[model samples]
Target: MLNRVLAVALAAGLVAGLAIAVLQHFTTTPLILAGEAFEKPAGHASLDPAAGLRFSGATIILAHSHGEGAHDEAGWSPTDGLERTAFTSLATVVTAIGFALILMAGLVLSGDPIDGRRALAWAAAAFIATGLAPALGLAPELPGSAAAPLLARQIWWMGTAVATAAALWLLIRTPGLWAKAAGLLLLLAPHVIGAPRPEVYASGAPAELAGAFAATSLVVNAALWASVAVAVGFFWQRFKPHAS
Candidate 1:
């Protein structure tokens, strides 16, 4: 079981991570670079510049896995695009591994045989739950943007992700009116409750750029999750025969 998990995770993570890293280089990373210009007073690069899916928060979570010192928001940053890009790639792979584990674990718990079609469905649901659900409440933020307390926002995002996933499971796996209604409520609950709100609406970056950042985060996440699902799904089946 352990070997199977590791195999699927590494495969999925590398494929998904590399893909998203490329996507962000062109899509979200530029926005972050632009936003950083407004963050520092010197108008030079900020210390510990931001990275992949910078708006979505995944990059930070994953980068820590590579090494505790990989990213230090407090430290001074050098103007090294190559280093930043390399780190971003590492972050993406690490993040993908974590998410792939979750995906594969869900399948194991469900006792379902893996296949491309089912994997696609799983990936879509995962994307909806983890990516879209939280995003609905908390769109990605740029530097210098007004926002809620970090802990509060994290709590809300987590709750939304869990609720959305539960709702999806209920709707897809269970039948009957009660199950359906419950699923619907779970789906709507978080949005109705709403995400953590900013205390004051403000940002150093232009409103347009901020909007672009948020939209790009959502789009990139959707694609990343979908691709991850497919890759993991393919490898899971391929690796299954050897797990025994």
Candidate 2:
């Protein structure tokens, strides 16, 4: 039983980590790269062309022309190199493991029949608290340097919500290969769609950073859904009565 629980926890954690890494790689990394690329050319023109070459090695360069100024009031900054990427990835994995263990323990304790609607309601509340709440404050504040195209960001968020909801609904309500496939698709959708791209760059910054925010939200929601699944599975197992 302990082995099984450990296996489930590890699997859930791995999946969650992979999903986050892929999303970040496709979404946030590109924005950072774009910011870097833009900074090179913009800085070159604003400063000595030769001096701009010196800035190439710098992972993040903050340049503000007389009028360009800083991005929105938000103090968000672009992620640097592999250090930030690795840190983010590690954080995702750790969070996933913690969530899986907690949910598994909760489900084992509850020992009640799975209630799809109740599960969904709980999932939705978790989604709002974990996914949307931080976004409300963090989204707008993301440094303008990482700003992505508005339409693309909107599509990413809408798709993420729909995919995540569908994945969770199916995973808990149905038990079949189809549900698994749906969940996989939900996990891969952001990468398939190609995360939002930068629309414009000024002073080495994108106009908006919503794509990164949306991607982060998606990752959080994915972990929540995974927790729901582990919880539901544990509940069903614990509550099943043995033959007399």
Candidate 3:
């Protein structure tokens, strides 16, 4: 069963990740490059070395928003064009694989028969938890955007995702009014606590461009999640007997 699950998830992740990478190259990449133009002029002081440019699977979720002082040559980054695309694609595929694994785990935990439709439902829920929930507080940001400290924002992001996931599970899996009420409160607690924010909400990017980038990023991420769902669902269905 474990082997079957891994097989399904790996295949699904590769397909979805490659698809998303292509979609992002066309959609979000242009916006990012445009935003970079608005970033601080080349001479600005570089920030922490640890936070330097890193192209990794977590980049999509953790650091999509490039903040001030984050674009120094002190750190290595994939050059624009083919190299950048290759790294981005690789990172996205790995990220998608992780997501697929988590989704499969959820199915296993629920002990429900997995199929494309069911996998999609799970993916939708996952999106709401990992994507939309945190985004409520921290909309997708662009290069040159004002942001709170990276560590603070990361802590909040992870908390929001976990809290939202737990709240969702409680709301959907448990019965009773109290449980439902608690779940609702849990869902709202993170927002109520508030997301970390910069002292000043400033950005070098034009307001219109920033807005467009945020919207586009969200849409692209949604597509990625949906793609993962479809792929995973198809593969799971194909290996249902082994999975069970």
Candidate 4:
């Protein structure tokens, strides 16, 4: 049974991760390349290394208002060539598979017979636990973006992920109002403590590009998580014991 569960999860992850990588090539990767262009001009490489940039509402509005250009993603560059695409695909697959296994374990702990439907729910929870929640404090950074102290960000990021995961597990699996309330508190605790922020914010990338990247990255992650969950769920259900 354990082997079967793992097999199903691995299959699901393989497919979803490939899909995400393809989507990212067209979506986030272009933005990433464009952001890199600004790196040299901004004197960012030699400047502050500990000031991570984040997307503000303004940058997204700017990106939407403009159309394609050099900074806005014009003709494809050699940077977005086959090699990069292949590497990205490989990395994404590994990441997705890891998450799928985590989700499977969570389902087991839920005391529910793993099924497609529950797998989907667990995926959603996992996303919240690992991605979106933690991102509340640390929006994805583009290359050359300033970052907070490495140690600080790492601590907060890990703590938030763990707290969020625990909260979700309690909320979903534990019975009773008190249990649910506890979950809600855990969910809020990390945020209350706040994510570590850079002493200052700076970026080589234009705000418009940075904003677009952050927004797109979040969207990409959302798709990746959902696809992995559904795929994992489907395969898990297919492998489960039939009604007898």
Q: Of the candidates shown, which would achieve the greatest TM-score relative to the real structure?
A: 3
Identify the candidate with maximal lDDT.
Answer: 3
Ranking by lDDT: 3, 1, 4, 2
Candidate 2 local distance difference test against the native: 0.55
Tell me the spans in candidate 1 whose CA falls farther than 4 Å from its real position.
40-73, 76-79, 240-244
TM-score against native, each model:
0.81, 0.42, 0.85, 0.79
Candidate 4 off by > 4 Å: 41-80, 240-244
Which residue pairs does candidate 1 place in steric collision? 47-77
lDDT of 1 by residue, 134-224 (tens): 8878888987677899999999999999999999999999989899899999999999988889766766577899999999988998888
CA lDDT of each prediction against the hidden true structure: 0.78, 0.55, 0.83, 0.77
Per residue, candidate 2 scores C-alpha lDDT tens digits across 1-244 of 5665666666666666667666767765566555444454433434344544244454334442222333443254334567667877887777766666655554445563444444445545446434663344235323334457667677676766566556665666568998888877765565566556555545434445445545655664655565555554554455455779
Prediction-by-prediction clash tally = 1, 5, 0, 5
- The better candidate by TM-score, 2 or 3, is 3
Q: What is the clash tally of candidate 1?
A: 1
